[model samples]
Target: MTTPLPVFAEPWPEGVTHRYLTHVGATVDVTGGGDRTGYRCTGCIYGSSGQYWHENVAHERAQAHAEKCLALPRPTQ
Candidate 1:
């Protein structure tokens, strides 16, 4: 029999609570204030999208985008 993969656990952010996972697939949902921010791989094998299971190439791409966004100077609000 094949062994089940291990799950990834990240520290819950402050003021943010509640997490759910399922055995049918390898996705984890994190919710706060009725808003579904995004999903993370329970197994850390897939990127933000499960389409790239076992590969975090998409995650890296997302990280690059986020970095660019952060690097951009913000306008006074």
Candidate 2:
């Protein structure tokens, strides 16, 4: 039987506390607790090019990317 892939565990940068799981097991991490927030996807090269003044905007962006990103979780070594 094939072993299950390990969960992603990269340390979040300061202020980043939200992690949104994608459909393909990838992650979209959001940074908050400040005037500006942003998101970065672990499965694809897509990410926030600039800080978002609204937290909800960042969340929405993350969710949108998660819905379409089909990249599988990265391998852990």
Candidate 3:
């Protein structure tokens, strides 16, 4: 499997813009290894390329994002 791309902030190309995309659990058809199959995936890519953009292009943005994410509320059991 290919490693998923990391999110970062930078000046998006001319075509890129920020927006939120909804994600929900659903069955998806996928073909792989010469076989057609379906499976479930976790999480959702809700934001558009614009939403993924970062104010700072420097790699430091990763750390900032991490901290921000950590501050978010966690689900209660």
Query: Backbone clashes per model, in order?
Result: 0, 0, 5
Query: Best candidate per TM-score, number?
Result: 2
* CA-RMSD of model 3: 16.7
TM-score on alpha carbons, each prediction: 0.25, 0.69, 0.19
Ranking by lDDT: 2, 1, 3
Which of the predicted structures, 1 or 2, would earn the higher lDDT when compared with the native?
2
**Residue pairs of candidate 3 with colliding backbone atoms:** 9-54, 17-50, 18-50, 18-51, 21-46
Clashes of 3: 5
When summed lDDT is taken over every stretch of 10 residues in candidate 2, the lowest stretch is 5-14
Model 3 error, position 3 (Å): 26
Residue 13 in model 3: lDDT: 27
lDDT of 2 by residue, 1-77 (tens): 95475575767556677988887788888876455888888777778877564787788888888888989866555
Q: Evaluate residue 71 in candidate 2 and report its C-alpha lDDT on the 0 to 100 scale.
A: 90
TM-score of 2: 0.69
Better of 1 and 2 by TM-score: 2
lDDT of 3 by residue, 5-64 (tens): 434354432332221111221111121211222121112221122223332331233332
Task: Please tell me which model should have the higher TM-score, number 1 or number 3.
Answer: 1
Candidate 3 positional error at 7, Å? 21
